[model samples]
Target: MSKKKLWQSISIVVATLILSFSAQSEEIYTQNFDDFDDGEIELGDGSIIAGTAASIQGGRLQLTIDGQGLGFSSFSIPPLEGSSQGFKITFDYEMFDSVGANDPADGFSINYGGAAMGELGSAEEGMNGKGVQDNLSFEVDTWRNGDAEQGVNISGYGDGRDLNQLAFTNGIILDDGQRVEGTMEISWYPGKGASFTTTGLNTNADFVDVETGAFTASDDHTFIISARVGGANQDLFIDNLVIETGAGGDSDEDGLPDFWETANDLDPEDATGDNGAEGDPDNDGITNFDEYENRTNPQNEDTDGDGLADGVENGTGDYDGPEATGTDPLVADSDGDTLLDGVENPTLPWDEDNPEKQPGTDPNQFDTDGDGIGDGSEIASGTDPTTEDEADENSYRQNFDGFADGTTDLQDGTVIAGAAAEVVEGRLQLTKDGQGLGFSSFSVPAIPGSSNGFRITFDYELYDGPGANNPADGFSINYGDAQLGELGQAEEGMAGGQAIENISFEVDTWQNFDAEQGVNISGMAGGADLQQLAFNNGPILNDGEKVEGSIEIQWQPDVGASFTTTGMNTNADFT
Candidate 1:
């Protein structure tokens, strides 16, 4: 071959190699601090490391106290050419020392902009530490400032743009004072905008993704991982940084990629005004830009089919507030507790701590109280969701106050024993002048022997007999194994004929004998013949006249039984 022909072939081969390199994925930067000494870092490039208090320790960046009550540190990388296809930056971060402490101030961020480094200053400065224009920053705010704003924040800055501040109401995204370990990812597509994603940020989320709408992507950009602590103390650390370039493109310059726009029937060219990224035709309060980011349907209000609008569940758009649910928009069951977020809270701006419109459980947590039972189960079982506690499922209760309307009947399963027992004047009449005996029984499921305890309460009145000085046989409150309707003469209440082991509280109005007189609490073990009084008090009943009072009996398996009586005339020990 001739020399000119050989040169032509070599040039063609060189061009092909360059094309392949451009199309392929490449890792441009990575830092783990594995080889760095324990002290100030040495990046060797035109990198800036601010705050002398921080150092490279334990193969990670350890940032500690820099000032007396406030500390600040920042690590900035030199500008590098951005990939036209797409680029992804990932790193692991942790913040500690503010777990149980009060007022954990300031926070941390990962800033990408034209500036080489961020200004170590106020948290309200857009990026937590703002300095450059045409910047985009992701922040993890740890404290609630005077403006009543905290949690995770993502913002976009430009010269002629209205500062795009992504809305999120999860105050304090990182767990205070605890050692929180989480991964953060920043993906940038030139001319198409970027996305910020976080996983396990102690935010009770599997992952959270936010986006920046159509923005001018710079040809080259620098990075800064910065943190500040003011009016409180905290330690922030970072590790396992990786930056790479791969394939992604969005023709519309919206947050949604080209393929997604095509699939969703959205015009790729229409990203401005009111019909594309900024549009919310469904009126669910979530813009089309966010619908794409959340992988939800832009045309549907309840994209997850969970009976809740995306805005209500995600605390976005019109639902943004200090009391929003902060649940996942794309998921039906955000906490995976077998209950949908909509079913748990249902309304926007619901407080998990105190529910007013509905019995709102925490949509972000399965067990809101860290109890063994989930919030779904707690709500269903009528238990408190905000505290670790047990529920007494084996119990029965009845209130007679509703019966005062004279329209209600006895509660279901209530057993009335005897012809004289009836509901008259909105009260249970156990006995009348013509009838000598009556009984009312309520049987509850047996409680286990190794149980907490139980309580019984009652109110009674004895009035209007044939003679003013002579009342009837009186009444008794019984609990135990006894014949349901055993009524014996004028003496026995529930401890009458053929009774087994039981406890009976008897109020004797007739005073048949010395042993059977006064108010008595007796235990009938084998039979009525073997009954003995556990408590006895002198006569307190107003014979044939009005005498009203209440009684309470509490029994514990380990502590035995105790009794309390009210409105009794005699000063006697009922316990």
Candidate 2:
């Protein structure tokens, strides 16, 4: 092969290799902090060491506070790129006494600043004495006391001026049998300052607004895991130290980091600040996702649960039962009857007047009688339910006269007989006993359909009277005319008359000279006149004579007309 041809083949292979390497570089960054066993420093200070202290498994390193051994051990990595921004640091740590009694002279700190460990201040030295510059450090100190002036400085870097502190007073101490297990997280926002939270120490609190400038702009920073114990009497245990950048730890994706959630007793997986589990906590069968999305009670079986639900119980009135299969829990009864509350009784058929009795009560109760309806039905019909049944006529009836006109008589005999008569407003009234001897007259309206022919019937009696010296006084019927007196006049021997075309028989057994007749008059039109006749010189009966009777006059009105009566009986009575 020619040298030029060989070189071309090598170039082709090199291009393919470059492409393959580029493809394999898809991952951003990954670290579980489990690489300490290899005795290799992937990044950061080769001086930082790892070993086990208080536990079987080991992932801890130590740094002396005398400022001589392992000066500022650090772990460094490149920042995440693209729109995928932010970085987080998390770790677990414990503090203890090296010689068996509590030691107040030991401390440690984790710092992030520029890329070199030299940028981190010494752990045991006050912030003022350390030459560290341009950095943020969360220090755990066991020596500093109430001097808020020197512990965990937030801004300004030197002793007596350090603005933040996590002094001995703030450090958490475990009992003989207890252990400190906690996490600390620091999150860096692009344009915003760092935010952090610490647990198992002090108040186990969180804070933001540190003075490290903006974390996003400070790209190449080092992570230092360092500790110091002055006077050689303190020891510490560290486990589960983790450093993570980018996003997967937030299960809820709610922007709050996972470390903060664990420290705050909040569920990292729950976006709603409710329970952490994925589905309904009450096992009521509702999905937690749906509940959260819909703003419903994820733990409750019913959402609006007014005994009703969507798609089934609307407008049915049986809201208490299962969905559509049951009745609507609303309307009382759309049909206006007293039947179904909902379901099978959409058109309530049960009579409201006679509502169905409750389960154990009388089923056949009908509050209204004879109407074939119930009390509820009466109410629905707008009638009085309580008084719907017929009233007791015998108990309510009143007799105007001393005599009982039968207990069933709605009107007793207070109205008189053989006097002026008229039906006023559909009510009939009468006055008896002639006011002017045999010369008086009375009038009654012409009833409908009473023309061409009609009849009037009545009963009478004469209590006492001397036999008439001449012809007996009598009565007569007239139609649109007068002078029809003595209607086939009553002779002395005759007690009554036979039924005629429009006249009927009469009775006169009282012997008071006063008399009455059951009379029917036919062929009367427009108006009519009735008269009482006096036999030659015969006097009318006295007022002592009493009579009881009823009269009905019938007519056919080819056209409307009036009726009147002339000459009243001198003696008339009622009982």
Candidate 3:
């Protein structure tokens, strides 16, 4: 990737504000400490009366006075429904005074929880409460309690009294706050419950920001801002505290639910997010919805959009037309064929091996058969576009027409041998009339390139003799090194070619007595025996009959050659 050649647009939008959702209530509230001017000093909703020791002094609501005694205070608030925005609470406060450096006894808390102020407000327990346990709250501890996460002595990954940690008994926050702002945000959705994030700053600019992740919200709760001082040395004040909420509902006004917007880049909030299910953004003729359902690109008429409509090349609906191959909507010919991917792969019946045979041509090759013909032209021409020998050098199917009647050679390089080797009616006939174990072999010169595998196909007639009862002389098909001389030898079975490594398919037909006709094959490790085979139901041809078939042979380095036959006889298809 060259950085200099880069030309792209990138932008990141941060959600500084809460994401708005449909809400049952639009109620919102706030207090900037200016509400203190309303009348006598009071905090929150005034549901829980302020303790005598907890008073407003020098402006800020004093949760503890002159560090003299235990003090607790709370503000009643409208209870929020679980289905609403639930609530968002924010506040600012200053922790002042000097006392025990690491274990100061004076501490305060701002909690919005299930515990009631009436029970916790008792002087012996309530008004003097420093913290109400077993619930969620923000604790500002100016002391060290060994494991206190905010202990002054604790110094690792945002730990100190300079900031508050949002502790939880039931919820978690997704995104937490940073430093410098004692700003904490809590959001609770209807069924999803709530999460809290606490943040604060100090003189050194060092602070803590923790998110309480999220959790299920259960039961009802009120608000409290309390402080407790064991001695008269430290004081605590809280100011600018507020809470608000709204309905948490759907985002997009589309008559569909969020789950239905599974289409690519479909925004749930904007009605315009959908161009229309029927619209063809890619102009590929396929509707965006159909493309979505088919897992194609709607934005790109041609997912591979290379000058071709996705449909033109990919076929319509489940029907992959002739050109409807799995071509990229963005790339014309994924296989690099000048013929176009759609030309190579066409829509066809679903087959596990469809991909392997798609386009009817190699997507990357213009001439899959290397016969100097374009695949598109070949495919359209109604001829084999993949078989190199579909036509000979003269562009005609090679059927031995050029063999010159008595010759022993085929235009396609097939070399025939045997005293009886001759061209009869365009068929290279390899036979000897006065037969006694007579045979002939045809070795063609084509790289079949691998000893690993090769196939030979041809049509032939087994002369079963004119009489329906007359016995017939049989022949054998042989394969070995090409240099193997005469494909047949007098009476020593099928032999020839010095230093030869050969294998043969013997079609025995001297059916005299009970010596029935049979077909057996084997490597030249002597010869194959029908009885030695696990099964044999072959030589399925009567004397003097024609049949067409293919012989495929595969070789393993140390295992030599193995083969199978696929042929058509008058009786049935042998596979």
Per-model TM values vs. the true structure: 0.38, 0.30, 0.31
What's the distance in Å from true for residue 79, model 2?
6.5
Question: Which scores better on TM-score, 1 or 2?
Answer: 1
How do the residues 334-446 of candidate 1 rate in per-residue lDDT, one tens digit apiece? 66555666656534333445442244556666666675555655555566666777545565554332121111124333554454554455356666663333444333334
Ordered list by lDDT, greatest first = 1, 3, 2
> What C-alpha RMSD separates each model from the true structure?
26.4, 45.5, 33.1
| Alpha-carbon local distance difference test for all models | 0.57, 0.37, 0.43
Residue 566, candidate 3: Cα error in Å is: 85
- Considering TM-score, where higher is better, how would the candidates rank from best to worst? 1, 3, 2
Cand. 2 TM to true fold: 0.30
Candidate 1 overall Cα lDDT vs. reference?
0.57
Query: Which one wins on TM-score?
Result: 1
How many clashing residue pairs, candidate 1?
Answer: 3
Q: Per-residue lDDT for 355-404 in model 2, tens only? A: 34211111122332333333444444444433435533322222122111
